[model samples]
Target chain A: MRITSQTTSDGVSEHLFTLDDIPGVIWSPSEGTAGRPLVLLGHGGGQHKKAEGLVARAHRYVKDCGFAVAAIDAPGHGDRPKVERHERLVADIRQRVTQGEALGSHIARYNVALAEQAVPEWQATLDALRELDHVGGPVGYWGASMGGAIGVPLVAAEPRITAAVLGLTGHESLTEAARRITVPVEFLLQWDDEMVPRDAGLALFDAFASREKTLHANPGRHAGVPAFELDSSARFFARHLLEDGGPAEVEESSARLDRS
Target chain B: MRITSQTTSDGVSEHLFTLDDIPGVIWSPSEGTAGRPLVLLGHGGGQHKKAEGLVARAHRYVKDCGFAVAAIDAPGHGDRPKVERHERLVADIRQRVTQGEALGSHIARYNVALAEQAVPEWQATLDALRELDHVGGPVGYWGASMGGAIGVPLVAAEPRITAAVLGLTGHESLTEAARRITVPVEFLLQWDDEMVPRDAGLALFDAFASREKTLHANPGRHAGVPAFELDSSARFFARHLLEDGGPAEVEESSARLDRS
Candidate 1:
């Protein structure tokens, strides 16, 4: 891992770096972070690692929970070079959007492809992030829409993530992955989401095998998730990640951290 | 209203009382409650004012938020004399339950009748409670199942109530009343509810005219609402009832309190 730039603002240290060719960023308290928990954020389609909402949420997680947070550009998002296949997929989705046709199948296909690559990238990034002195503790993932599309499979494949806040995208393509997940989950759904049908969202929430999953639904379109959810998310993460807090297994796992 | 008995325990003062023919109970901080907020809990069917769940929740509200809470026996329920009509309704419902027949229509009819008598009794109780030195403040309501059934109409009819936590019972009978309510609401739904159909619950939540409504859905049967919901309810009431706490109008209305 190579640190490209570092800056501190509002008591949070932002570090931009690259691992091989994958660009990513990590945020922590400006003061020394000895053993804070970590949260990984995945941005939506057409959004980058530092999307405005992602950055605000990162700040909240850092300040409210004293947790280190990180985000990385997906294979064709942010500063990453767009492959021909991804370009074609985006073009197809955009055309469908303009034609007022359903985007579920196309979006799901694109998301599946991204997850195939992004999951491995996230795994590698977690391996490297854990090696850092400031970012080594129980981990959580927060993502929605395309982020959720990718996250369903990633969380299924990654054992390091103990909990996740995922929703806003739903497809049969992701059902198997969702069923395999056993960690606690807080899933958000927009009741009137234009892109995702309400039944599909409800069905996806039903697919989660996690014994401690919750669904928070609100009245809005695809992009109008209520602000109070941020507060709820902060609490959810705190309940699962912080030492002397959350699940006993989390604290037990922290005790087992090798931190070598 | 006449106070029949009063006891103090666990930092909460419990008072048993009667207004006319109505029997009820009130809970508040054992210490003098000067201007704390108030919450009204409506009990479920086959249960009374001092039902185990209602008493537990009342203590929580008093201890956690320093709020006064109250509950009343609905007509033909809990220390109230059962009339021939109520007996016939109960017999019908019991038979339906035994035969595995749908009880939606029968239950809705029974709830509608109870609400008519219950709403007036509640308003009278509120009027009397607010006259006490420790019980005058902004008002909220919490009830589910039959409590929700009666509560839908009561909250709709009572302008003094500014927010509510209601769910677990859904039917067309309550649709009109639900639409008339504009207060902030937190609606709960058990995904696999045995009594209420999923669509009916979703429809009722959708019928609420409150601009700020949230739906918390979990995978469980009707009687399996998770315990964390109690904590969430306390925060919801706190946000809407306390001075400088919730909606602007609630505070404005409190300032308008004559206290005569």
Candidate 2:
């Protein structure tokens, strides 16, 4: 499943790398030939390589911030072989449950399995980025919704990610996955969003193992993502990936205000 | 533009009324020939007539439980005529903003316009539903996400609607369209969901001048509406639409609490 790297006429380098022998796409800036920091991007449900808006944003990050980005289509979505339609996937789960499968655990397992298969793809993309001369060292991750779900497991299992930003997604463990992630994470929450419950998101934030985590709440619906928030995400990535270790001095000073 | 209704099949005793005025297929159960409550059902963004999972669940209060249902598609989605490609739609907003249209106001207008166009279709659908002996009486409204946004304007503009149930949709008063809505409202919020911010949702809830209002907070993400919550929505709709004079017992309790 290793994807071979190819250079386009535009001089942008592309590659298919395999992890767990699973295939994934890697994109690097044309100017950056040397090693640089990599940012792994994961698409949400029913999305493919170029389908995610965040992926395009990730490209901007690579160009403006001098980082490489890698993204992969998940199982039953995008370029990945479609084993079943979304309805069929749900039906299969239902059938299995009717046949005695533990419904709750099965749902969790299904998500984990889907995430596991894509892990190698993420790893391979990371490997390709690491090989680049412009790539610094290690990598970061950014995901939205379903991609946010995968980012949790990816960061938890892979220590290579230096920082993570999860937008419009949260869970309490795999029961609510947000709680399981130990990394320095930033979560973007939508208030009146119907797709995901706010309390579940807050629970995930509460469960995060990192003391440095931050939460930003914005106004918008399921499809709304304000431009300023995107800027905030960029700032978070820059702070964690490019700046020196520990919270900025201002943040530290504010952190000490609870002494009273 | 008003659309007339016609009967499709007569021999079966239950006449099927059809309205070709709207962009998508909409149907109503022929139960009442006269004096039945009119219920309008709105589908979320990127959804069509049947709205199987989420929309269907929301529509239960109007359909299986009691109220007559009228379903319509949103703009550039479902059976509606395509206005622009997905990327183009987003790009158009950006273009408009660059030309001096305030970003928030423009988005609200775009959403309201989409809903307004669909209203004629809904009116036509209601006309068709009225053709049946089973449908009569005051209209009630129900919608989730984008549907909620549309319902807000529709209920405000149309005095025919007696009540409404809006779920999982809200934003700041950045748009004038949002400011016009005044209705008996119920808001469902997810604290951690990233698609919409809770603060923005709360602000919208506060903006409503409705004497009757309810807010529910749960744990979930933009895509994670658990089965239990779906059932709660059914109850919510039933309380407003199906109950004898709008759940007298609960209202009394609420009133008592208010006085206390």
Candidate 3:
């Protein structure tokens, strides 16, 4: 879809946006209440958002479950600067390898920078949402493959993120990124995948200490996400991000809880 | 090294060669008293001959154990057709893929063509090799990753190949091609690799019902082939392809075999 800036709910305002310079389409649901919760989506390696089945499934979850979603490209992927031309991106990656930085630490720093840049772009979108008087404040994140790789650090660093779902990605230090994720997390794996081995995927899952964590595995390949698993991922984000009858419910309940 | 033609003491006498068309150096060891056995070395994905430790080790076995070696490039890989326009390559790939062909199968066809094309160019080189008197006959084959994928079909179809070492690449079927390979085989795998998952590799190995066979697994990633595995792989081919040895020695040898 064409990336452009526009406002909804009577067009009282406008937002800034751009086409994913990468190879995928990012779709923001047109039907969410003002102040609704926001969920961000990321894509995998050699794949744009449109290529990853999980990202599209995630959009469904946010839309039907009553949340706004923001899908963006990962570094050296999607619309972000090409890994070859972006010296900072390359140097950052080199530093991680040369210094022997923990996988988690390296991923955290890279993801934070990715989010820092994209989050502002998202802010304008969120601002438009906030102006609509329907969107919520609690933001969530989701990704698969390289997208999942970026999702981890983004959620961990951004305390505002309420929950996350990562698929076909997440493993122990790839080169040197040790995964130390704290946000509520969910992981999905393919039992007989050739692109990414199952053991590595499991090791990444085990490293996380999140009490609200889940692992899902199904028969598939590196090429596509299974349909059943996608449904499960949607259910997960719904439980944490969309429950409470939308932002109005949270706003109303917080007042009562604060009074009590 | 530049690609050139070469002939050997093998009864076949003349064979083409091209060091410039492929990524690594080519060495033609002197033939034994009898016709020298030929061993072709294949490389893994995103890698050339020198990148994988096993390729060099295999070369050593060919040298010390009396076997001839020819290391060639897969399509779109190494030095062959290096200056071709991207559009031409993509169109060729699309044409192949549209015909319901795997990238490897097309690559195998391309490699065979290159081999045939190099024949005229390699005549002088072959004459020099014959003067040096190395390699008694046609050629045997071995490869990992893309090399392995190409080797599977090539060995099965080409009668000149007496045996093969199929490293990290294999799949159940390749387009319209299906046949039992008559030659002896050996397969290698990395237990924790994220690329070319172990299962797909194993399936390819199983498809080859070689009465004489060996399987080895080491701790590493897609690019992590240890220096020692080559010795084992070479030993495998040596037993089956070398004139002095046979299946009986393979079964008796203590090569630290891992069936899984």
Task: Give native contacts recovered, as a fraction, per prediction.
Answer: 0.38, 0.00, 0.00
* lDDT of each residue in A1-260, candidate 3, tens digit only: 24365654321222334443432232444543466676666765555544546445644544445455555455466556675534465477678778876444444345545545544544444344444344455777777766666666555555677787876764444323324556667677665565466667767765665655655544456655545345345545655775554322332332332233
Candidate 3 clashes: the total is: 35
Name the 10 consecutive residues with the lowest summed lDDT in model 3 chain A: A8-17
Give the lDDT of residue A15 in candidate 2.
63
Determine the C-alpha RMSD for candidate 1 after optimal superposition of all C-alphas. 5.9
Candidate 1 structure quality by residue, lDDT tens digits, A65-166: 678999999898899999789889999999999999998889889998889899999999999999899987899999999999989999999999999999
Q: After superposition on all CA atoms, what RMSD does each candidate show versus the true structure? A: 5.9, 23.0, 24.6
After superposition, which runs of candidate 3 have C-alpha atoms over 4 Å from their true positions?
A1-3, A6-32, A49-55, A79-81, A85-134, A174-180, A245-260, B1-260
- Alpha-carbon local distance difference test for all models: 0.87, 0.58, 0.52
Compared with the true structure, what per-residue lDDT tens digits does model 3 show for residues B149-195?
56666666666666776666544453222146756665666655554
lDDT of 1 by residue, B171-248 (tens): 999999999999999999998898889889999999999988999988889999988788678767877787655422
lDDT of predicted model 2 = 0.58
Error of 2 at A61 (Å): 0.8
DockQ score for model 3: 0.01
lDDT of 2 by residue, B210-233 (tens): 655545444566555444344344
